[model samples]
Target: MNNISNKIKLRREQLNFSQEYIAEHLGISQPAYVKIEKGVTKLDFERLLKISEILEIDINELLEKQYIVNNFKNSDSSTAIGMVENLHQENQKTNELLIQTLFSQISDLKEENKRLISILEKLSSNK
Candidate 1:
């Protein structure tokens, strides 16, 4: 429960969202929202889903205890930031590879077109 609370708080803060904003979204009072973050109130699944949506995070991320423990321990934001950066880098690499493959395919198609044009010119001249 404490781990969940910590994760919610950490994610909220990371997004720079105020407690009152989250409370309004949840249709609850600020104090009630605070209790949820403090681990004094238990959150229902629906409410948890709503929170995850509002935070723009996956429900599994909010619910994973081990990940929460590892990332939130000592309130280290760098670990999470580093993970996001790494994912971004990987995505960039994948995009670059995809672009390269497309370009190569286009070049091959252009060459094939040129070869076919030359063949057609030779055939027409022979006639």
Candidate 2:
């Protein structure tokens, strides 16, 4: 299934909710809900927000921007907090690596430009 569809299905299953239950809440048929989980139906913003409310999850979780669903079944607040902290740390590390790579690329481009300018200057001098 697609990423969003998979997230929806996973969240529903985590909540022990049936397709019929979700469909009823959405004012749609069970088949339509099934299509949503199966990635056959495209969810609009409003529908997605509704589903997120019914699932008791943040919309960003369904969009795969944040991953807090793994802690849904945990009753321990400390454990949930730890999980969120870990995710935040991981995201920070990823962002740092990305910034470093971008800076390196920029440095390389600046060196290339300098070399090209020197070459142009030499050609002009010859002319």
Candidate No. with top lDDT: 2
Model 1 clashing residue pairs (backbone): none
Candidate 2 weakest ten by summed lDDT = 90-99
- Candidate 1: tens digits of C-alpha lDDT, residues 62-98: 6553535555566658877776676566456545645
lDDT of 2 by residue, 1-127 (tens): 5667888999999999999999999999999999999988866656887999999999877764455575567558887787678657755654564566678778999999999999999999999
| Per-model TM against the reference | 0.52, 0.51
Question: How does residue 51 of candidate 1 score in lDDT?
Answer: 96
lDDT for 63 in candidate 1 is 59
Give lDDT for model 1: 0.80
Candidate 1 stretches with Cα past 4 Å from truth are: 67-127
